[model samples]
Target: MVRAGFYLLAIMGFSVSGALGADAVERAVASCWACHGAGAAPKDPTMPIIQGQQAAYLEKQLDAFRSGKREDQIMSSMAESIPARENARAAAMIAALAWPKVAGAATAPAPDSAIACQSCHGADFTGGPGPEGVAPRLAGQFAQYLEARMGAFSRGEIASAATMTAMMKALDADERAKLAKYLSGL
Candidate 1:
């Protein structure tokens, strides 16, 4: 009905914009807003909030997706949609947008194991430089996305961080869930 029409309009708009000579980086970022939401939280709980994420982290992920190191079919395509030379520019653009202020469940007390994460993710869980590299912000991220990523790391499905893989593998699923819940409420 109306929802379907909106989608059609959006798709057509994208096509028209590209055909009208919108640059690759602008097109790539516009496509991100389709799923990631424009300056707001995504509707799907499983999708991560990319706005205001560390530019370095975003750039690394885009490269990983483009190189086949990361394995989401849709993301692979999205990453590829950006010209290889414009990956950093696209990441910077996305990172420059404000992070959405999402209200959710109340914050819980931090798990003891969560301390280890603070060294990289910042004491506030807003993310910072780590020994490994730039850690992405965990505070206010979706619990479902966090939990899924933790599980992926545990299973060695995400190849970006061996440290994360080893750390996640040490924790049981329950522990990871607890961590995700705690982080999301911040």
Candidate 2:
């Protein structure tokens, strides 16, 4: 009887642990999909597609937002409520999703703008590596989303002194729109 009771208790304990783990993962994923899924695409032109981003990069950005180190109203609010460990789990899940191919006609950038952007965003505008912690992938983003974000930085709506912002400031409105359209179709 004693041995049987011990085994039963062990089983129950494991069951409870398993359930909790599953719940944690589910909650984290739901929170992320709430904003990133097709339904949540902000009507504005600036929100980037988060559907199939690199998990490591996503996790880093989430951490930055949570820590109040990154600036964006929506991201800050969302990240603020997530615990660090859970954020990491969410990031992993997002990263696991397959990247979507960009659709529609590709817009071309002016030669000057193309030269300025090619170094970090890649010749194709798919993001490439730079010094550690320097760049994020820009390809496959929605044009409206990209445009809105660049406009925000240009208007001081989003707050990051990062090189991207500097680059944004250099572009005229037409260039920004062209790049956004071009990237979305990549």
- Evaluated with TM-score, which candidate comes out highest? 1
**Tens digits of per-residue lDDT for model 1 on 1-186?**
999999999999999976654476787789888788777899888778999999999999999989988878999999999987888888888888898977555687788899999888999988878998999999989989999999999999877778999999999999999999999899
How far in Å is the alpha carbon of 164 misplaced in model 1?
Answer: 1.3
| Model 2: residues with Cα > 4 Å off, grouped in runs | 1-22, 38-47, 71-74, 101-111, 132-134, 155-161
Residue 131 local lDDT, model 2: 44
Question: Which residue pairs overlap in candidate 1's backbone?
Answer: none
Question: What is every candidate's alpha-carbon RMSD to the true fold?
Answer: 10.4, 4.0
TM-scores of the candidates in the order shown? 0.85, 0.70
Give one clash count per candidate, in the order shown.
0, 6
lDDT of 2 by residue, 42-157 (tens): 33344566656766667778887887777778888787666557777777676666665544436554535756767766676656465434355667688777787788888765
